[model samples]
Target: MLEIELLGVKMKNPTMLAAGVMGSTAASLNWVSCSGAGAVVTKSFSKMPNKGYKNPTTVEVTGGIINAIGLSSPGVETFKKELESINEEVPKIASIYGASPEEFSQVAGEIEQIVDLIELNISCPHAMSGCGAAIGQDPQLTFDVVEAVKKSVSVPILVKLTPNVTDLPEIALNAQKAGCDGLTLINSLGPGMKIDLETGRPILSNRFGGMSGPAIKPIAIRCVFETYAVADVPLIGVGGISNYHDVVEFLYAGASAVQIGTAIMNHGPEIFAQICQGLEKFMEEHGFQSVNEMVGLAHQF
Candidate 1:
């Protein structure tokens, strides 16, 4: 009942394992797929290896956890090895980032053959150098990167955007014009931080990082709802989804599919099955025959 075809890639259900959560290796990606996630996104990688921030990368906050892992990656060449090892039936998406359009294109081109989709992670709040939100926050940069990647790869591309932007719809429209097949909204929030009362210091080594959990859902929904109103490309909703109910809300807010991340920290890969089961039951009781039927329901009003 939850089957969805996103940018020509078919999925058994709408749930996807968001990038950055148990997505650093083939084993974990396979595990999430086995646990019932329809698709999985690998951790964001770059053309060159990045060690990212030091210890104390994540900390618990009032609403959710804040993390500044610095987008550490083992580089594209090494990540390709892990990607080739995934043995799951579900579609695999490679989440990539770079400091420039050429770099982004290079990474996407190399891995296009190994994955069904490429997610341009231009919204990581804590990315080091010039890689993350710096690209996403500018409409021109978003277009340049998306256009470059589109020219380099045949696989469908989704630009994961930052909610930290002031003109999100403008950025979303630019990506569409640049030929992105779809969009992933609201890649965490803040660059928020937590302070240790006893130590009188920041908990995370980076001082601040992106926030993810139940608290960011409303903003995520708003971003999706707003972006849907302006862009024609499909959207993959993310940020703080923990239950089937959250998935339904995203659909109604205009998401073609939903991705689960922070919730995985609390529920493990099993969250996929639990959410799928709950989604199926919810669909049955609500008379919704397919996930498509629920997309953008709120826009009508």
Candidate 2:
């Protein structure tokens, strides 16, 4: 009952593995697939290798954990091998990042034929200085990146946006105008930090990082709702989703699908099957025959 189609790619359910969780390798992606995720997105990679932040890159906080993984990637050439190894039955999305539109286009062109979709990582709050939320926060750069990727690849392009922006709808609209096939709302919420009281030092090596987990769900839902009001393309919601109810909330908020990230850290891959089974039951109880029927239902009022 929860099958969905987005950016022309078919999903058996509206659940996908969000980038930067357990998405770095073929084995993990396949594991998520076997566990019942309809699709899996790779950890964000770049055209060139990035060493990322040093030790203590992640820290636990009250709501969720903070991470400044610095968009660490092995680069596209090496990442291609990992992509080719994923099971064909499960659609694979390669999440890639670059500093400029040309660089983004070049990377997208390289992997277009190998993956079902390409997620432009314009929203990583802890990414390197020139990349990440900095570029996505600007509508013009968001437009340029989307336009460049659209020009470079035949595969569907999804622009992941940051919620840290003052005007998210404006950026979403710009992406649509530039021809993005879909949108992924609210990549980790803050460049937030935790400090050690005794040492008077920041907990993370990078000093600050993006927050994820259940704490960000409300903001994610709001971003999805607001973007749905203005965007012409489908929306993929990712943030603090932990169960079937969270999935239903995202769908009700207008997400065509929802991506699971930090939750996997606590629940393991088994969470995928658990959530899918629960979602199927919920759909039956709610009298929804398909996921499409549930999309944007809350907005009807």
lDDT of each: 0.93, 0.91
Clashing residue pairs, backbone N/CA/C < 3 A, model 1: none
**lDDT digits (tens) for residues 14-86 of candidate 1:** 9999999999999999999999999999999999999999989998777678999999999999999999999
Ten contiguous residues with the weakest lDDT in model 2: 126-135
Query: lDDT by residue for model 2 over 62-147, one digit each (tens)?
Result: 87899999988999999999999999999899999999998899899989999999999998888777555588989999999999
RMSD of each: 0.8, 0.9
* Ten-residue stretch with the least lDDT total in model 1: 125-134
Task: Return the TM-score for candidate 1, rounded to 2 decimals.
Answer: 0.99
Evaluated against the true structure, the overall lDDT of model 1 is 0.93
